[model samples]
Target: MINTILVTDDNVLDNAIIRNYLYKERYNIVSALNGREALELLESRNIDLILLDMVMPVMDGYEFMKVFSKTPFYKEIPIIVTSSLDGVENIEKILEYDVFDYIIKPLDHINRLILVNKIKTAVKHRNLISDLNKATKIIDTLSTTKNI
Candidate 1:
């Protein structure tokens, strides 16, 4: 299960609600008022999952994702895009980003739980894969040294 979360949104009420819910659920929560703030915090913190907002005053989600993609570390962090815009056009807009999940605004509690669980499962799988990769690399190095 993911212990930490990064929530990025410009709406104070939205942020508070999400924070309160996650807090009640006993999950660690970190928040950013806008994409720019989120990015700065992201640079310093290794969070388990991201809940991103699409529209903001400075540095929207799409732009943030574009810049985030350039950083190798950000690639592995799963992002769940949250936006008030649920129309086909908006969904289509963010589809290219390959976000782990999408949540429409007025964030439903059950839907939020679903997203949380999905992130937990994904994070667990990621850890397993990372461990396996490390083991494989070690084995390969040992085999090569033995043959030398």
Candidate 2:
């Protein structure tokens, strides 16, 4: 079960909006004003997913993704990027970081639903993949023993 979600956006209003929406869904919402703050939270929290905003002060989304991906602790945490920028180049840049989904700013009713569902799906997929990896390791160990 996904227990924690980290919301990283420089905009204070945006953080409030995201918190309001996600709080209703009973998720433990952790808010950060910038990527630097978000990184600190990740070091201390078990965040299951991240809602990342593209533009920010101190550290932007792109830079954050670059740094975050290099670490094994929270590298696989699913990220759904929230951006006001809409362009092919911007999207391509985000895609390079392996984000699970990209949501444009000013999320409406439909977009909210979609975002919620996407978070649920991403968490589920991560859990499934973890289980598969553990099973594979067990199988490999058993096979080695059988050959002995």
Candidate 3:
């Protein structure tokens, strides 16, 4: 189960709205004023997903992604960019960063639920792969023992 999420946005109202919505759905949340603060929170807490804003003071989404891509923990952490700029050009720009999805402002209930489910599915798939790798390791050990 996804226990928590990090919602990174400079706008207080946007963060509050999203936070309240998620909270009502029983998801614990942590809000970050900017990408830098988000990074710090991520380091200190176990966050399942990040709803990142494209523009902000301190560090922006692009900068965050650049740093995050290098770290093992951040590499697979699904990021859905939630911004008001959902124009074709803006979407193109964000897609270049390799985010999981692009969500526009005034997030509707249906789309929000879809986003949550997508994260759940990804987490499930990741866990299955991890399990498969573990099983393969065990099988390898057994085969080696038999050969010995």
Candidate 4:
């Protein structure tokens, strides 16, 4: 299945660059200008992943993550922070949101490869978790039947 990715960034050029990089992967790309828009999209779309920018107007990445984390339905969606902010402190701050990974902005060919690889890894992880949940449910049902 083709995964849908939400790209939230105030910079139009940055969004375009990311779109270009992911185009080859055939992701159903959805763009949002800020956190508010991203939240709105999330309400209506089954987004598989998110590419977020740290500094944005209306709502920044941290603010978005705060709300996203609190929402149980959104907690499973893996987020990859794509930001210009780079430092041990900054990375730690973003990591606190339970993001899948963080990538420095101004992406190039090498970074694009890195981003694609990370996306693949995250997708695999999500699929594994889903399968495990399904297996657990089946086991629970089997146990209940055996007890009857």
TM-score of each: 0.83, 0.87, 0.77, 0.92
Candidate 4 error regions (>4 Å): none
* Model 1 global lDDT (CA atoms, 0 to 1): 0.82
* Candidate 3 similarity to native, TM-score: 0.77
Quality of model 3 by C-alpha lDDT: 0.80
Per-residue lDDT over 93-144 for candidate 4, one digit per residue giving the tens place of the 0 to 100 score: 8998889999997788899889889988887776777678899999999999
What lDDT score is found at residue 28 in candidate 2? 90
lDDT of 2 by residue, 50-130 (tens): 999989999999989999999987766899998897899999999998888998887777887888888888877767777
Best-to-worst ranking by lDDT: 4, 2, 1, 3
* Candidate 2 vs 4: which has more lDDT: 4
The candidate that wins on TM-score is 4
Clashing residue pairs in candidate 2 are none
Taking every candidate in turn, the Cα RMSD to the unseen true structure, in Å, is 2.4, 2.0, 3.0, 1.4
Which scores better on TM-score, 2 or 3?
Answer: 2
Task: Compute the lDDT of residue 93 as modeled in candidate 1.
Answer: 82
Give the per-residue lDDT of model 3 (tens digit) for 1-148: 6558799999998888788877876777999989899989998998777889888999988888888878875765778888878789888878987787777776678767776676566556555656787999999999999999
Per-residue CA lDDT of candidate 1, range 1-148, in tens? 5467888999999888877877776777899998899999888887777888899888999889898888887776788887888999899989888888787877687877776676567666556766787999999999999999
